[model samples]
Target: MEARVEVSPEQEARRIAAVRRYDILDTPPDGAFDRIAALAARLFDVPVATVTIVDTDRVWFKAAYGLAGVTQVGRDPGLSTSAILTDGPLVVPDTLQDPLARDHTLVTGETRARFYAAAPIVTRDGHRLGTVDVMDTRPRRTTPEQAGALADLAALVMDELELRLTALRMLRVERELVVVEHAARERAERDRAEIAAYAATLQRTLLPPALPEVPGLEAACHYTTASVRDVGGDFYDVFPLGTGRWAFFLGDVSGRGAPAAALTSLIRYTLRSTALLQPDPCAVLRALNAALLSESADGSRFCTLIFGTLVPHPAGGFAITLTGGGHLPAYRLHPARRDGPSQALARAEPVSLPGGMLVGALRQADFTSRPVRLLPGQALFLYSDGLIEARTSRGARFGEESLAAHLTHHAATNRALGAAAIIDDLTVLLDSFAAGPADDVALLALSAATATPTTAPSGASGTAHTSLPLPARHSM
Candidate 1:
C-alpha cells in the first residue's frame, strides 16, 4: 500500500495562485486544447481524457473527451487533485490494487475508473496547475513511450496558455488607454480649450510616446501641429522585432480630424501586427495597402508612407532596407571623410523609390524597396511632405531643393551630426516661420554616433518634442 501525500497549506495556496494567473479557469471551449484532449484519449487507449485545471474547490475541465455532460467535479472526488500533488507523471496500473487510489470516488463510484494515468501540467516556476489525464474502465499498464508523450502534451498546453496570457495583458493595456482618452474627452466638454485639448489628446494616442533604445544607434523625433483646433494625420514609430532586428515607419494620412485619426490608428496597428508575421519591407507595405483598401468603400482613402527594417551589420554599423509608398524622398546625410587636408562638406542625397506609388490609392500599386548601409557618423533622415509644402514668412513655398540645401548647410557646419542635433536644427527652422508650418510636420532622424551618450536620453529622443501652442481660436 502506497502512503498518501498531503500538500501543505502554503504550498496549496501557491499552486492555486499559479492556476489563477493563467486566467483560464472558465474560458470558453478552445479547439486547440480540445484537439489535444482528444488526441490524448486516442493515444493512451483510454475511455476518458481531459485537460483539467484544479481549482480551489473543484477540477474544472478545460477540455474533455468522452466525458459527456460533465464539466466539473468536486476537488475531493477529482483524481487530478492528487496527480497535481506530484511533480512527475502519476500512473495507477490498477486503482483497485492501489490502496491510496482505490478509495477515490472516481474509482469506486459510477465513474468506475479502474486505470488512471496523468502527467502534471507544471509551470515554468515549478507549480503544478493540473493534469493531462486519462482514465479507463479496465486496469492496464502505461508504456514508457505513452508516459513521455503525455508529458509532451502537457508542455503544449502550457505554451498555449502563455500565448493567451500575453494577448490578454495587451488587451488590458489597450483598454486602459481607451479609458484615458475618454477622460480627456470629458475634460474637453467642460473647458473652453476643448479643441486644443481634444486634438492634442487624440494626436498623442495615434503615435508612440517615445522611441526605444536600439543598441549602437542614436534616434530622435519631433512633431509640429499646424493648428491646435484640427488634428493632423502624421505618425511615426520605431520598434524591435527580436533577434537584433528593428522596424520603423513614418507616414501621413489624407485629410485631418476624427476620420484621419481613426485611419492613422488602423494603419499603425496593421503595420505592427503584419510586420511580426512578415518582416520583409515590401511584403509589409503590401499588407498595409490591402488593409487600407479593404476598409475603403469607394477606394478614395489613401496615405503616403515609408517602412523599413534595420539589421546590425557585422562590420560595426547597420544595414537598412527602406520601401517608399508615394512618399517624398528621404535623405541620407554622409559626413565628410577627413582623408584629405581640405575636408569636403557633408552631403545630403535623396533616396528615391523609382516605382513606388501612393498606398491605398490603387489596387495594383507597386512599392520599391532599396537597401543602404548606415556607417559611422552617417544619418538617415525622414520627414513628412509638410516641411517641403510649408510657406515662409514671405509666402514662398519651402520646396524640396531649399529643404535639402538647408540640411546640407547644417550638416557641413556641425562636426558631430547626431540625430538630436539634426532634429534640434530643424525644430529651430520650424520656429522661424512667422505663422508656423501650414501643415503638420513629423521628423525622424537615426544616426550611428561614433562616440558619447551611452544610451539616447528619453527626454530628447523618446518623447516627441512639439511646438504646439499656436494662436488660432482660444476659448479658455
Candidate 2:
C-alpha cells in the first residue's frame, strides 16, 4: 500500500510541478502573503487559511494564519488538487458528494475533512504557481459573496508573487550599475546645495554695496531680512544722478522667505529700470504700482514705497522731494549741542506722509509728496520700522523718539560715523533684549546745508507743502 494518499498520481505531479517554478526555497515570510491568508479565513469563515505551495513529496505553506503550530501538512490533494490542475479557479461546494473524493484519505482519514475550496494562484506568465485555499472542518455551502471574496483574495496572492519576481529582476539590474546610482545621488545632492548657495549670494548682491556720497551731507542706512534662513522681500537704494543731484527709495513687499525674496529682486530691478526711464519721483512710483496691480492676478499684492529725488541748491545744500506711500516717516536731526548748555543751530521733525489706501486694493491710486532742504550741519534720516522698532534683549523697543534723539546727537557728525554709532549701540541693545530679531531693518540718512521751505515742484510754485494723501491700502 503506497500510503493511500487522496491525490492522484497526475494531480500530485502537477502540484509538485507548479511549486518548482517559483524557486522560493526557504524564504522568510512577508506581510502581503500573510494578509491574504487572513482575509481568506475571515471571508469564508474557515478555521484555517493557507497560501500553500504543493511540492514533489510534501505541501509547503508560505503563509498560514489561524492554524496552530503546524506550518503545513503533506496532505493528499485527491480532490483539493482540482484547483492546482486547472489553469482557472477551482471551487468545490461540497466534498461529501464528489465521486473522486468520497473515499479519499482526506474524507476517511483522521482529520475527516468534509469541505474544500481552493483558488489556483497563477503567476503573470500563465504558470500555476500554487493555491490560495481556505479549509473548513464542517461540510458547508458558499454564498455568491463568499465566492467573489475568495477569488479576490486569490488574485491578490498572484499579484504579490508577480511583484516579488519583478523586484528580483530589478535587483539584478541594479547590481549591474551600482556605481551609476552612487554618482547620481551625489550629483543630485550637490545641485540642491548649489541652488541654496546661489539664492544666498543673489540676496547679498541686491543690497547696496556702499551708501551714497553727497558732499557735505550726512547719511546712514541699514537693511535686514526678517527670515535669515531664506531670502527676503525688503530693499532700499541710494544713487547719485551724475550731477550734484541724487535719487533714492525704500520699500517693503509683502511676504517673507523665498517667494518674497523673488519679488524683492523683481522690485529692485524694476525700480532701477523705471528710475532711469522716468525720473519724476511721483510718476515712477505710480507707474510701478499700476503695473504691479494690473498684471497681477485678482489677489495680486502691492508694496509700500517712498520715492525721492534730490537736487543741489544754489546755496551749500541739497533739496529733497519725497513722494510718499504708507511708509514710516524719515526723522530730521539738528545739532544737539546743549550737552554743556550751548544752544544748537536748528530743530528736528519726523517726516509725515499722505494718508490714503494701500496700492493694489483699488483701480486708481494716488500718492502724496513732501519737500525739505538739508543744510550743512543738518541731517535727514530715512529708516524702515525694522530699525527704530528693533526689539532689545530687555524686551524694549528702539522707538522713534530714541531714534530722533540719536539723530540729533549725530547730525553734525559724519554720515558713516552716525550709522556706525547707531548700528553698534542697537546691536548690543538687541542682544540685551533677549534672543533674536523678529523683523528686518533698513535705513538711509542724508545730511546737507539748510535751505528755505518754499522749494516746491514746478507744477506748484506756491501751493501747500502736501500735494496728495498717503495710500493706506498698500497690501501685497
Candidate 3:
C-alpha cells in the first residue's frame, strides 16, 4: 500500500518565498563577489553567509562564509536569482515577521532566525552576480561605527571585481596577437611562391625556344642565365631574312634581372629586325646602338654585342663578316693539322666594330667589321664576358687560353654535341678554378662544308702543241 503524502499550508507558503531569492546566472565571476560575502558575515557576526551566483533552479556561491562545498544551496530553500532584485538591502527585520516563519525549519519555531541581511552583488559593468547574504538567530542593529565598517568592506569587494575583469581582457589580447602572427606568415609564403612562378615565365621569354635555320650554314648555340631568379639582361638570336643572307647576334647588358631582361629583349628583336633590313654587319650594330640610345630614359643602361653575316666564300668556304661593339672577342678553332695543337683565331686584336657603342650609353657610336673564312671542318665561336671573366678558384679569370684549348679539342665534334660538351667542361673547369662562374654564360658556334673540284696545272695548256709537232717530225 502507498503511503499518502500531504502538504501543510504554512510549510508551502515559506517554500514559495524561498524560491524567489536571486536572479543571476551564467556570468563571469569577480573578486568583488568574495569580498561582499565575507563582509556580510563579519558585519552581522553571523556564522553563515554567501555571495551566490544564481542559475535557473539553484544558486552557486562564488565565495562563502562558514560553508564548504555547500553547493546544494538552500536545499530547495531559496533560489538566488530572485535575490538580485530589491534595490535596498533585504533586511529580515525579524524572522517572526515572516507569515510562514514557523514552517521555515531553519527559523520559525526552533533556532528562530531573528536576523538577516543581503546586499546585491554588483559587477564592474553593473550586472549582478547574486547577493551578499548573512543570517543570525537573534535580532540586532548596530551603531554608526558598525555601519561605516560594513561599507568599507563592501568597497573592497568592488575592487576585486575590477581586478578579475582586467585579467579577462589580458587573455583576449594575447589570443589576438597569435592570430595576427599566423596571418602574416601565410602572406609571406604566398609572396615567395608568386615570385618563383614569375621567374620561370621571364626566363622562357628571354631566350628563343629553338635555333633558326640558315641554308649552307650549320649552326649551334647555347644560353643560360645565372639563375632563374629575377629577369636577366643577356640574350642571343639567329634568324633568316627574306633575302638569302642570315643574321646572328649575341649581346650582354650590364646588369641582371627585370631591367636587364627588358633590355635584352629589346636587343633581341632590334638586332634581328635591323639585320633583316640592312644585312651589313656594321650597319646593323650601328642601328642597334642608335635605337637603344633613343629609347633609353636614364641613359645609364647599355649593351655590348657582336653581329654577323653569313655568305659563301669563293675559295670553297663560308666568309663570315663580324662586327664588334665593344664585345668580348669571338674565337675560331681550325682542325689540328701540321699546325701543333689547334689554336684560337679572332684577329690580332678586337676587330674595330666602329660606329657602335654600348646601345644606351651614347647616341652616336661606331662599329667595325672583320671577315674570317670559316673553311670546311672548321668552327666559329662568339661568347659573352660571363665566360672569360668567370672567376676561378684562386680568384683569377678563366681567360681566353682555357676556352681556346677546349674549342680545339671539341670543335670537330657535331655542332650540337660539341657546344654542350664545351659548356659542361667549362662548368667543371669553373668549379675547379673558382667556386663557380659568378655570371651567366652565352656561347654560339657555326660550322659548314663546301665541295670543291681538283684543278690541273695552269702552265700546261701552252706547251701541249709544241710537244706533239716535235714527236711527228721525228717519226717521219
Reference-based TM-score of each model:
0.62, 0.49, 0.49
Q: Candidate 3: list runs displaced more than 4 Å.
A: 1-189, 338-356, 393-395, 409-434, 450-476
In order, how many clashes per candidate? 1, 33, 31
lDDT of each: 0.80, 0.59, 0.56
Writing each residue's lDDT as its tens digit, candidate 1 over 381-443 gives 999988988877788998999999998987788776688889999888877876667788999
Give the best candidate by TM-score: 1
**In model 1, what are the clashing residue pairs, if there are any?**
210-462
Model 3: number of backbone collisions: 31
The weakest ten consecutive residues by lDDT in model 1 span: 454-463
Candidate 3 per-residue C-alpha lDDT over 81-131 given as tens digits, one digit per residue, 9 for 90 to 100: 334544434555575664533344446433355765555555544444455
Best by lDDT: 1
